[model samples]
Target: MQKTKLKALTKILGQTALIALITFVMSEITLRIYNKINPSFVFYDSSYNRFRGKPNAPDYDFKLNSQGFKDVEFTVEKPAETYRILGIGDSFTYGVVPYQYNYLTVLEEKLNKSGQKTEVINMGIPGMGPRDYLSILVNEGLKLNPDRVVLSFYIGNDFLDNYMTANLRTEEKSYMIALIKSMIKIQSNYKGKVLNPTTVQYNDNLPTFTDEKYLEDTINKSNMFVRNPADGMFKGFVDDAVKDLIKIKQICDSQNIPLTIVIIPDEVQVNSQLQKQVKQAFDPNNQNLLDFEISNRLLTEQLQQANIDYLDLLPDFKATAQKTPLYKPNDTHWNIAGNRLAAELITQHLTAKNQP
Candidate 1:
């Protein structure tokens, strides 16, 4: 009886080992095959939550094809006598479609025409908010010793960006690799959807996030989407934001360089009249929108109290959004025209401040 029991136990252990080996082999094969088919992690989807599909998702540095600043690239650092402007923000700052008039490029051209001896570096990354910009300021930007650091703080998502998704672990290459891997998984599940969603043509030509529908959803969900634990005014995010602001202040003060914070308007805060249209389109029930008044008051009050110099662009952005759609239809990023407007506004402010 003892001999029979021992034999049974051995047989059970062998089967378990065999199963483990098969599982490992399958996972390896899947991972490899997946990488082969889907090169980019980004995919297209029509789901409201995921307007643009990102199944396997690229790393933070993955440059999408529609990026606005694709035509613009930075060269090696030049001498200090040459004025350099480092522009930082999320995708808006990094134009979605390649262009000559992307705000950064626009500013550079304008500054050059005036002979300001300036080079504007587009340091914008998609999905980054204040924290990511702050990180770039310290880690990557300061080394160049920019004459002026223009921080374009997008009111809509930067608040959330400050609290969450601040620090990312992967570098650009590893991120691209992971994105490729994710694409493979998506292809496995994909039926007939095109690889690029935004590439498709649409007639409405409405801006993706700025519409009334988006603002309503944003207002309702704002509370649910904090960038960090201290996203509220009196808490950690406020303190962190202040600290980040101060750090930039200190850098400028030390270098005797001017610092400007360009407060980029979120589509939600463009005002009730404009927001109503979006509400009508997406949620006639108006179930998802937030109270713009309360949010605007809180944000404005904080910056004012901090004594930070900011150019609130809501009034102007609202007018522009009303006249022409500033956002792309398939993606949550500003189109070239929107970028041009932003740059023009910033230049006007700067030129006004510098006037003799």
Candidate 2:
């Protein structure tokens, strides 16, 4: 009886092992197939501070050059008679739109069309902040021998991100686990409501607002920066960010590379209707509202003190937004129109500076 029972147990164990092996093999195959079909995934680089888009991704028809940047291959030794500008920033610089439609590409085209040989290498990575920008410039950007370095400073969350850098890390997960999680919708994209005036409901007579909750949250967090600069948390972030920018300037100055800091305003800043909505939502009882430009003014003051060449896009974006939508209705990043306008402005500035 004992021997018979032992043999039965062995048979059951063998069958279970075989089933597990088959399941693992099937999962591996499915994951490979899924990755091939959908390549718009971002992977964590242990070396970099944030996630990087998958190299040679097919989903967005995106291709990462050898250095993992979403740009064409470039040599450390820049070619003669060719001017290269390294654009570094967060997603606004990386651009959600197609590579061809990106502002950097448009800037390059506009410059080249005007008989200036230029190459704008996009070193922008999504979710990066001033700290990462400084690091990338010091560690990698200087090696490329760029003539100019353009830093696109998105004011939405860069200060917050720079202050809260301790929590940034890429999780370690196996391919099978990643595939399973993705299949089950465990990974989700951020869905911030667009504050563009044209897309939201507006009543000329009645006070109307959309995404009051988001607006409230934004106000609660960011209002301190404008209203109370002496707040410890806000002061800390500003100090660190200024230090990072100063470091960036020092590096560029040492290398004899012209650094241009482009200040990108928040969505609400450019949309007057949205600005009104924000005021209504955040302070319904009061007629006076804090100027949203306070944040930009603070940064501008620092740049001026440091003698950093900077351009604020709020005025230009505000003017252009009056005629057409510059940002997507559902997303925070710029649309094609915004990208084109930015390119035009940057082209005009650079060309003017380049002129004898």
Candidate 3:
């Protein structure tokens, strides 16, 4: 009886192992097959009607690196010391729209048309925030030794993205995980095919909260997961950003190169209804994400303390949105007309600064 029972147990174990092996093989085959098929075209959903037909690039060219970033390729031709500007930021700095519609390209065209010998290199990448921008500036932007650096700070999601990804790349294990995450995102093209549409509703008649006390109270009430960088969890984020801006200033000062920051205003800040909706999501009492505001405000103060030149494009960007469909109703990025306006504004600033 004992011998028979032992044999039966061995048979059951063998069967379980066989099933597991078969499952693993099937899953691997399915994944490989899914990878082989070219996915459908991905489109950016617009939140509003005005951004309809705004130009955008249909494909991604650069692959994500192990660092969770794409190796941005730039040409080595040096402009004849008249003006060579390297524009750095997230997707906005990146020509999100088609090549011609990219604001950097527009800025280049407009500047050239104005008979100013200027070379503007677009060093923008998507899904990046201030920390990533600063990292790229330290790691990549410094190589070219540009005459001037134009950094765009997208006010909507940058602060959060910066905070979230900061720690992921700081430690060795976490850095590897982030690299894998970026590689996984390369599969977004495949995943986006079956994506469902999502809509955000805003009551346009909502009133704006203009008081700081209300803002702080609202933020404290709404934000249950506030990880204060001062408390150490977000130290990587705080260090990367604060230090990077300092480095940017130090490098520019040492080389006599100029640095200009373009504060890209969030669409919600312009549309009162959008602001209220966002406030409701973030901090109903504060209305604005004071953390984001504090970070940018501190960055500006740091720039001032370091004597680095800067430009606030919020007013101009807001005005352009009011005039044209600069951003899609659902999307926070600039449309073609908005890109043109941004390019015009950036070029104008650069031109004004370079005036002898």
Clash count per candidate: 18, 0, 6
| Lowest lDDT 10-residue stretch of candidate 2 | 201-210
Per-model TM against the reference: 0.64, 0.74, 0.62
TM-score between candidate 2 and the true structure: 0.74
Q: Which parts of model 2 have CA positions greater than 4 angstroms off?
A: 1-49, 167-221, 229-232
**lDDT, residue 210, model 2:** 33
RMSD of each: 8.4, 7.9, 10.0
Q: lDDT tens digits, residues 68-106, model 1?
A: 323244545765557788887666775555445468878
Best by lDDT: 2
lDDT, model 1, position 32:
51
Per-residue lDDT of candidate 2, residues 1-356 (tens digit)? 99999999999999999999899879767766665564324322233443555555431455666655767778889888898899998989877666777899898888889886887899887778888898899888999998999999987878777655655333323456554555444233333222212244322122123355446545655463345545556656666788889999999999999989988877777877766766776677763655777778888888999999888998899888888888755345787788899999888777778720
Model 2: per-residue Cα lDDT at residue 352: 76
C-alpha root-mean-square deviation, candidate 1: 8.4
Ranking by lDDT: 2, 1, 3
Better of 1 and 2 by TM-score: 2
Candidate 1 whole-model C-alpha lDDT, 0 to 1: 0.59
Question: Mind giving the per-residue lDDT tens digits that candidate 3 earns over 1-356?
Answer: 99999999999999999999887667645544443342111211111111112123222433322322223234555646556777887767754444566787788778878776767777666666665666677776777768888888765555466455544334322323333555565563222222111232222222223344334433443232233534644334445565666676777777877778787766554555444654676646753343334444645676677676777766666565565656643445666777788888877777787631
